[model samples]
Target: MHAGTSNFLKAFPIKFAILIATFISLLLVGCSDEAPGAKVPAFKAPDSKAAAKSGAPGGKGPGGPGGRGNKTFAVEGYIAEFHKPSGSFQTMATLEALNRVELSAAANGRLVNLYAKDGASVQKGSLLAKIDDSELKAQLKQAESSLHLAQQKMERTKGLVEKNAATTTDMEAAEASLKSAEASVELIKAQIAKTEVRAPFSGKLGFVNVSVGAWVTTGTSIATLSEVTKLKAKFALPQRYATTLKVGNPITLIDEERAIQKVGKVTALDATISESSRTRQIMVTVDNSKGELIAGGYAKVSVELQSGRTQTIPVPAEALTLDKDGAYIFVVQDGKASMRRVETGLRTPIAVDVISGLNEGDTVITSGLISIRQGSSVRIREIRNNTDYEVD
Candidate 1:
């Protein structure tokens, strides 16, 4: 082949390739120009003053370049005010029978008889059930026979001793034998009495756990007896009110489970306050002769205490925050949130008693607490009453 011809062929291919790339580039430029609004302008640096004013980098917003200004938070505010005294305090209480006991077998034997039916009312000392007492009775008879023999021997020995036919030791031995026989008789009689389950006091009986002819041992529970004529509601009160409550103060008992309400009177107060709970134990008595109250139930006990001061500064419970330092609240001071440490007292479901560190007209921030910082600029977007604030 000729060298010139080959070189010409290679140059022709390169020229063709260049032409194809140029055509493609021109096609792309034409497409871009035809597209609507596809043009981008040249970049330019933003003005410092405009950037700062718009809260961009190096602006007045919090955590910005300068870090000099705090972010303004929009929050709901509450107005503190005086609240009326509640005049009473409520606590959960448990109801108990004035006299309640679990009847159990005192001696081990077969339960032979159940004289009183379940839920039956009985008089004091009434026979409620009986265990098999045949063996005990037999033992008692044997002891009685022994007692009779000892008595006869003692009489003979006394007569002989009186005639100086028996020594003093013989008479003493006879007396000892008689006393031993008497003790045995009494012991057997006591055992027999234990076999008979009698009502300790007049009360209604619970369901018998054991049936007739069931073998029962000592301390085996047979049934429960409760004198429901009167009930005692037991509850605890705060230690602060220990001295204010008396034995005769009237209280209201509400059994929410049964929807029963009753008036009761305080009957007893514990001698000491419970250190663990910081409360004083108390008991209130209520009549249940109509069988309205149930033993072993729960009740809401409301104790009427002396009315507190009419003017009490109360704030929404959610407005208060706690930390290692103690409870503190955020109040708007000079358009900024200011943390004020506070001492709290009696609390209600919706409000807290601010004993100090807060004022009646203070505006407390109740919402947007998570975004709030000490001395952060705050804007009150909504106003709420003391008890109308939202939690969290």
Candidate 2:
């Protein structure tokens, strides 16, 4: 039995070795078949510039996710082009009364009567108010009585002197007494006239603060009087228009308050230019006989010069960059900004006329001045035209 057991053990080692070899072969074949469909980590190519540029559909271009590194600036654009001036040139103007004054009491007295009410139209020399003149009247009566007695006495003295009954000194003294009484009467009469306040000129009157029996002093508050029969519309124009403006020149005033337009003449022009504004004052006299035009109302003045109209290139005043080198502007050409120096002419409130330095079809950058420099790339966000039509 022992010998049989030993032989079996020896045979078992070989059989076990054979069994292990068969299992290894089967595992190798199975792996080979599966390997055909297996996915090895995809051998990815290194990132290249071409890959980034030809990025996936609908991706940003050039610089990072946001695109090109050039800082993006939002700005407005304007086109410089020729424009015609209006048929008639218009300017800012203010309307004013031809004559305006606050009528005050000239003498100190109690107001006895007020002839006109507030907002009453009065004629020149018309009685406006009356002060208490009773005291003045009595003074005049007493002075006259004294003058009568003195005159009689002077006559008697002169007769006595002529007849040698009175001395020459007595005659001179009587004459002096008579003259003094007469002078007193005249002074009282003058005072009486002042008691009756009258309108100095034809105009419309305003409200009075005091009622009847109100004691008033010299230069006391009374009422306002303005001669609106003809209103004087005063406006200022640039000094360059001084020569063109002259007396008798036709002027049209637009009353903004009343929404009415009126025709008038250039009654006067200021002799000198105002140093502060460098403008000349023009006075237009408009007839307001119907009292339609109000004093102190605003108006727009326009004058049609008998000259031809012209076209000009106008740009916004903000676009101009001024320095020691003169005026310059940034113009966008071919996606790049270029600085161009230009000569400027007349300027209005919103725009300046480009007399030189720019031509038609020029695109001027109006905004984002700080974000851009010469040769900088720009994208147009919006555009505006500041050209204006003007009459020369």
Candidate 3:
């Protein structure tokens, strides 16, 4: 019985060991299948530290993704030119006639003769208009008769006084009577001369305002006569230009309507400036041999300033810039723009004369200057076309 019980216990122990081995193999298979389905956290890409070091936003380098490098700008410029005058010209003051008069008779009389007409050429002392002098001549004849009688009586008294037969007071009374009669005759003859109106100077008579037999008063204008062989042009200039405009300064006169050009010289200038306009009056004499220029016509005068051997640079007018520092321009070098302050001289619509602050051969940006600041990059698109400047 003891041997049988011992065999049962050994079999039981072998069975338990086999059951434990089967359970361990099933557990190992389940673990291997679950390990294939399990997901580890996704591997993230490393941040672009190199891009951050480059100062690009969002860790991106230059021109990478959203970054932008230096930008290009368009601009324009021109080559400088120089100008030299052939000859200098001066400015002049205008002129006027020394005397102007209208001839009319004082008394109302018949117009005996009309010697002058419109545009009639006359000489000084020539008879122009004559009135009837018959009444004046008759008065002069009567005075002459009385003077002759007085002179005979005075002669007799003087002879009597010399012969010691007449008193000295009687000779004095006869002399006084003769003098009075002679004065009356002379006054009548002078009245006759006043009836004949004569030309005061050599000139061309204007339109005849009076006709023959036309009654005229003392102040009535008979005709207007002016000497138009030469014209006097007067102009007012600033007081500062007084020294520049002196006697004998040559000037160019232009008639805008007729397109006629004339040359003249300054004849005189007012010594003092006018208190009202603060300008000095200058006069010039222009020869109008052809009588083309009229006295009341308007004219343009140009005075050439004498700038001796001055260094000047011509630039485009568009390149000029104004600021608190006066005027300036932009200069381009090595694809960058720089500002240069300049003093400007004569300026036209298209070009300007640079007096200072820029040297010859320096490149100036004509366009895109207003949009660009100092040290900004720029790309020149094309050069501007060459243009001419007009001087007056």
User: Which is the leading candidate under TM-score?
Assistant: 1
C-alpha TM-score for every candidate: 0.61, 0.57, 0.54
CA-RMSD of model 3: 15.4
lDDT of 1 at 75: 95
Clash pairs, model 2 backbone: 84-389, 85-389, 85-390
Instruction: Tell me the tens digit of each residue's lDDT in model 2 across 1-392.
Output: 99999999989999999999999988887878466557667687645555567653333544344333355556788887776654666886777888988888878999989886899989999988889989989999999999999999999998898899999899889989999999999999999998877888999898976788899998887788889989888888876456676799889988775689899999998989999998888899999999888887788888775454335677888888899999999998888789999998777667777878897889889998976777667888998745332313
Single out the weakest 10-residue window by summed lDDT for candidate 3.
61-70
lDDT string, candidate 3, 84-117, tens digits = 5424444443445434567667556788798988
Cα RMSD, each candidate = 10.0, 11.4, 15.4
How high is the lDDT of residue 20 in model 2? 100
Superposition-based RMSD of candidate 2 using all C-alpha atoms, in angstroms: 11.4
- Pick by TM-score: 1 or 2, better one: 1
lDDT of 2: 0.81
**What's the TM for model 1?**
0.61
Error of 1 at 165 (Å): 2.7
